[model samples]
Target chain A: MQAKLDKSDCMFLISDEKLNQFQQMIDELDLFTLVLPFVEESYQRSIWILDIWYSISNEEINRISNPENTMIYPYRNSILGIIKTLPIKRYIQLALYENERLAFLCAIYIYNELDDFISKKMAIKEEVKENFDALKKYSNKSLRPFFDSKYIEYENYPKKLAMLQNTVVNELHEIHKKYEIPLSWTFEKAIDDASKVYEAVFGLINDWGGRVP
Target chain B: MIISNQIEHLKNLYKDLKFLEVIQFGTITLPITLQEKRYDDALICYQYLASAYYENGSYENFHVVMTEYEKLCLTYGKDENKMYFYYLYSLLQVIVRDFDAAVEATKKSIKYAHFLKYHDLIVVNYYNIAAQLVHKKELEKARIGMSLAKFYKNNICESNITIVRGYIGALYYFATMGNNEEFQEVKQVFLKLIKDRQTFYDAKISFAEAILTLNLGQLEESVIFFEYAYLRFKEQQNIMFLINIEEYINNFNLGDKFQYTKELREIIKNSHRKPLDINNVKSVLSDLFEDDTSTLSIKYPNVISKELIVQHVEHALQNNETLYCFHWCFITDEIEELFGKLFVEQLLFTLFETVYHFIFKHNAEVNVLSKNEGEAFIRGISESEFFELLMELEEKLQSKVVHSKMGILEVPIHFGFIHSNQLPEKQASYEQLTAHADASLYYAKSHGQLYIYN
Candidate 1:
């Protein structure tokens, strides 16, 4: 079962729901009321996803190489796998609303993985290695401050996230000619891939430092 | 579906009082609700967000959110939405101590309620109006408002808290006006309404009681109530009441406690109402709106009803659980009128702290559970261990010297308890156990006993 939390709950956080809520929301994105807004959301969602994927992997940086098809993303399986492994519907939050809504959908999966590790009484050496592998490749300085244990300041987390939001906004505005702006991805896929980096830090902060805001 | 799902989860969070989470998730979905033309869902988002901000003591955020809520209601909302809009608007004004504006806002809500024929909303708005009016010292208008509240308070299922608050609002009016009989009447009914359960507004009642006793030349008598109300309001972070209490306590000479009280007040007043730290986070997307044709149909554009509309609520009764109930009463029943002035006043003033501190050891959980008044339980301990703790409390209470200005030495308190574990069957309904506790409490008080247990 997922935990219920709130602003008052501080680091523990708020909004409790089941897997179906997340699933239902993702399914609903396919039925957008407005075509323009829906497609725009899809584009923004893809931008966020590529930013996240690029942040972790040594992919063609800031350039989405969807030469085969504008709609078909290279990491489609991994993105879907991340969502499939996630216990709760966290990325559902990313599917609608903002131009760039980032939730670190993988945070849910990562947190759940941590939970499994803890309950199974397994050392997190393997998980930590996987996390660091994802972490070290980031070209963006968004996760710069939160990289080291000594630098993990909970008070500064929101500020850093806000900074990341600004960075994402600027990136969206430029629509870097270096990257192929995918026209083929669905809103559901875009949303599934959106939301990056912070929640991973959020999960780690919770797991190691037990500090969140 | 995303907006609706988020709204559904936000509603649940609000219901669960996970306000921080409400703010958390509400922040994410509110824009979606607005963007998707799910205005009602958007309104729900605003409602939860505003409340969450308020509950979290993010007053600046609260005001910001309410302003947006009001804007949303006016721009896209229909009649019923405007009614609720003004109702919430009234609350926003009240928080800032703008009594006149608050009263006006409430009356506006009442106007909408009248149009919608929502008797319950009318009742609540009248109560809100009464609260603001009382603060403004408009006793006659407040009385009328109170009467209106009482008339429409006939409706049942208005959520247990709202009904209780309506009564408390009326209680404030009656108590403030020195309508002692009406005050007592409303208080008795309210007490009956929440005998076995604690309420969020329990401190507000203490505040009213403090004001009533103060009016009756019982300033010293009012100290305990004021102190209780102060602590509780501080706990609740109810700034409005805390400010009101600060005004009262300025006249009170609580010595070191007053200084501590002043500091505590500063912390509470500053805590949630921090100026919006907008510098750290500016809106990156200032105008996300497309100004397209609104997905929602606009209706009932006329803001007010042409004719005065009235609706009556049908009266209904509702009332609760029990385990160990310890009723701690002060030992002052036998005092003469002459001694009452010097002894009772000085004694209360001198030792209320020491006494409460002493009792808090044994009765803090019980006091909080009962809101200082019904049924409480003790778990994770054997019945014999409980008795041993009780006996130890009695022993501690036997001799204690409280230093004060008058050099007042000591005071006694009566402890009455209902130990259900000691009962033959140890299985009693909530009512039976509480009635038994109340009986023992009264018995101990009348008999002038140190300890009485059933």
Candidate 2:
């Protein structure tokens, strides 16, 4: 009797080739796996990373749109939530994840580039900081600043640098959309993701670009 | 804390008594120029004006202002001032019964209040938040929030903190696992204030004293203090205090032989038929009479039986030896036989009855009124000498005939009565023993102008 060729097995076989191509694309773009290195093995750590990533950029988007309303309690609190969750430890770890090394390297490079770009435009930071301090004193009153400092920083970055940063933020947005997660929860999740990425990258690099001799 | 135009208006009103009166008289308008739109302006203005009016004793204007404020908040608004306005507006809503709206607005107000470091407002917001949580049966969270509110009030507030503290204590006392000690402790704090005479108003102090006495089962003492409080309130034109007293009196006046109680009940009933300020008392009486006693096994109703009533009268008679002459004299001969004189109770009853009859039957002449002078009169004398002096006075007042020359029934009729004056304030014995003498003396003096030291 002829062996029945299992259709499902054939489908899986076909998908393995596509998986290979997808991995190759991930390597080339360094984007698909950008968050992967940041994600810990544990479900909670992964979720935390997701939260951080989503809230930070979503807050940035809100600050960009209503720059006039940026320094108010709700707006400033949203930004502060992101600032508090920035994964200082995990940003250095993303390099060591087998599938996410490229994405890990790229996220840091993009984040640094954006920070550098904002620093270069000293005027915007000064103005934003002034308004932020004013808000501290008179918290009851709503504060509106003259310029969109967050957007100005975004626009001033080099095109490629900007694209990479935008891609990382978009990936967070996509993860949030896929998970049906709240923006705040997603930002919280992303802090863990970023910390994992930091650990992976540091681990990968500290091994002298290889395993311990 | 914001020191907005509302505060400015309040400052103006409080500048002088005339301005306060003027604020009451005219169409009181709040400074609404601060906000951009009329609706938002009115929304904020109404709260400030209402509070100002309330503080200034302009209740009519306060009501009007709150009504206007309610309308502005309910109207649709996307204005930036909506959240800010809602903070004050929601607090006002609680005073009215827009509880659902207050709950919603309170959450938003808390967020704003925290941002501003307005601790007082934050405390109020927390109170409302806790109240809402309680309504939803979120007791644990409500308790936590209430604790936080109390913490803030303790740290920041000065005068009105007692009110919030009392509220918390009451909530703990009734709704939670608070013991009698907890309730008694709060009560003692207030009681101490009353006992020390630190409380300014006599009526207020007496009312608190009455409550404390009642809680301690000093029911007769409580009634006397309540009467004092009731009279003081009436003299002061304080309708609210009068109502509170009437309510308490109605709860306790279930006894059989209390003649004053019947008089009081009739007066209160007549007052209620008119638009007297004692509507609360009327309602309280109606509720107590309508409800079954099983809910609270209070001692009052049972203590009103005929035998118990007679015992109370007897006890009152013993307290003041002279008051034995008023109502005790006329016990039926049958009662005297059944409760024989060989029994101490019967002997005391008979003595009281005999005194009562003796005082009423004849015009007993009481000529001299003199205070008890233990020190001034007997300081130089020895114990024996002091005894001789007392015997001399006793003989002179009781039997010796120091008559005039013409002798027209001129034996000086001076009763050697012990005066109740110059008594130490804290002596329980004085209170326990003196009332009967004073009452009898007072009755004697009123009836026949008899001179008795009391």
Candidate 3:
């Protein structure tokens, strides 16, 4: 059931080898195995991931086909689109199964890549910066740059990185309170961990001669 | 400490249904709780945010907030909060029309509540389950569920709000089953409970009073009660209850139905008139019943003919844009015939006007086609827009009031749609488009959907 549901709409966009490597990473991280005990819960997470992929692919396809219809900033669109897919129910399910957090992390990592690609392709840094400024009003000052270069320290061992991630999560909680952003501690932790995973993946790809495909 | 105080402030706003304010404050409240590493406080904020989003019809945001709430419950929340989470999840499912899932989730809530020995939570879950059963039309089972709710209310926690809600649920069940005596009994109890209380339950009491009077054949009094209820519901933004009142009004019957409806409309229009004159009410009964097309004319314009449909179809095909053909058919022909051909035509026209407004609100283009056949077409619509239109139409049709010779009639409408792209349009022609849409309409009618797409 997991495999059947794992057939993402965006799977065709990537090479088979790249897809295999992504799946291997997911397996190595023991994401699906952690969710194995809860059938309905796991299935819901799978559906959510598929939905996110479907949306991202649709946006990508639309952008490619009709460049004139680009109304929203690509980076903002990708971030908001991915966030939209992770509603409260899925968040809880992922939180319940610790391993499932990896799946969320993987999704964010992929989206970060897409965001980068769109930003470079369209040369919309000024527009992207303006959009980020708008988003900053809703977020805290400390956690404003939610994704940053500090997370790309792949040379730091996983356990050390995990400790660093924990600190970021703790900081985010304070930021949330200071800013009065309506978010759960669990959600804050999940998002922080996802950012860590995203940075790690980017660091890994960089180490592998930056051959993302 | 300050965060809790802030939460209390937002809680007051939430109770007042000041959703926008609550949401604005929540942005700060949620982050503060999280930043302080107060998972429990964060959970509470999520609950408030979720409810606000749900009430405001921002399902996507609600889903996001609820997910966070659920996560917190699993991670750090106590059993009571977990039970509350399930209860909220069930309510959200019901709003989205997932009845089976709602029932399952409610059962989970009840289980958790029972484990925690929280009688109030258990009773609330049972009440919700009963409400879902009522929507399912399983009245007997709903009655049993309501009985359980009442039993729990009596035994453990007999709060005024709980008792009022219990009575309201009973009233709804009895009214739906056409048990007028039982309905009146429940209404009396409900009214007595709110007789002297300076509470927000006045709107609910007035609603119960409206139903009771309507059942007792006191049409004028019922109309007044209904108007009062509508005003209160609108102010509170209690859309669900408002929809219920609209449904009840749709089935209203007076001796001279047409004249009474006209007078009711006039009274509603006269917003400045407070403590309405009894003479105006009496004049409604004596006034000559004129079939006025004025209201209908103002609401609906540019009624399309069959020839016009062909032109629209040609234009859609030429532009390579998607055309959404919607077919609406009344369930009861007898009711239509009783209302007279002209009156029925006017009603259909008004329905078209409502649909047009609804479509345009979603930024979709709509054109009324073949007014006599109750057909219309929309173009350049997305799936989400189509679904939103269906929801709006369902609410409209359920609540729309029309007077007929045989008392009052709530004509059940069958709606179906087909996309132009779905048609076998080797050559884009009206014959092919209509034929395909007609078939989809037939399927939707048989399948009992507001609208089915092909």
Please give the CA lDDT of all the candidate structures.
0.48, 0.38, 0.53
**Which sequence of candidate numbers ranks them by TM-score, best first?**
1, 3, 2
Selected candidate, larger lDDT, 2 vs 3: 3
Chain B TM-score per candidate, please: 0.52, 0.33, 0.45
List the DockQ of the predictions in order.
0.01, 0.00, 0.01
Ranking 2 against 3 by TM-score, winner: 3
Ranking by lDDT: 3, 1, 2
Candidate 1 local lDDT, A89-197, one digit each (tens): 3223322111111232433223223223322322234653443333222211122212212222323232333343443333322322222223112223343333222
Q: How displaced is residue B90 in candidate 3, in Å?
A: 3.2
Candidate 1 regions with alpha-carbon error over 4 angstroms: A1-213, B1-31, B52-58, B155-161, B184-199, B251-454
The regions of model 2 sitting more than 4 angstroms off are A1-213, B1-44, B52-63, B70-84, B87-98, B151-454
Q: Where does the lowest 10-residue lDDT sum fall in candidate 3 chain B? A: B281-290
The true-structure Cα RMSD of candidate 1 reads 31.0
For model 3, how does the per-residue alpha-carbon lDDT over A1-213 read when each residue is reduced to its tens digit? Answer: 132222222323344453454455444333212212121222323333433433332333432221211111122323334344444334323332333334445443443333333334333445544433333232111121112222233222223223344433343334334433333333455444453433433233223222223
Cα lDDT tens digits, model 1, B317-381, are 01112235455555543332435555664544333334344434442332211112222343334
Identify the leading candidate in terms of lDDT: 3
Q: Looking at every candidate separately, what fraction of the true A–B Cα contacts under 8 Å does it contain? A: 0.00, 0.00, 0.00
